[model samples]
Target: MKSPEHPSAGRADVRIVAASPDAARQVADALRRRFAATEQRSYPVDDSGGTRLHLTVDTTHRPEPAQPWLVSSRSSGDARTQTDEI
Candidate 1:
């Protein structure tokens, strides 16, 4: 017997299986945010109450973070002294 071939380096075949289609789609959407991904395809699991979503992502390119929390503050004062009125 021969072994199956894998995807090329920096490319991946991602599968999101969940109890509901919404759950699977959410996971696929998250992956799309982090990598260059193809449109997701959906399939119903055989005899199971679950949905399967498949997509291909290129790991070599990752998009910028949705929220840049690591950026340093430019303020001259200490962070503890900063005040914000809500």
Candidate 2:
């Protein structure tokens, strides 16, 4: 069977910051499920507090993969930023 076209296809490089590593993994897993062709990586914060997670997903495609949703913690103190490249 053929797959459905993604809403945000043709975009690449999705970056997100979460409250914890688990949260980041959860969000990445969710995105991977949503986009069958997504490649995800997570970086957990290693410090005294241990309350931050950074994640990056690279979706491979000819033109590019769709733009994935970013997951950021509400208590992160800074607003999240998103950028797109074509």
Steric clash pairs (candidate 1): none
The C-alpha lDDT values of all candidates are: 0.85, 0.53
Error of 1 at 25 (Å): 0.4
Please name the candidate that would achieve the greatest lDDT relative to the true structure. Answer: 1
Instruction: Quote the positional error of residue 3 for candidate 2 in Å.
Output: 34
Local error of candidate 1 at 47, Å?
A: 3.2
Question: For model 1, what is the alpha-carbon lDDT of residue 51?
Answer: 98
Q: What local lDDT does model 1 show for residue 9?
A: 97
TM-score of each: 0.65, 0.38
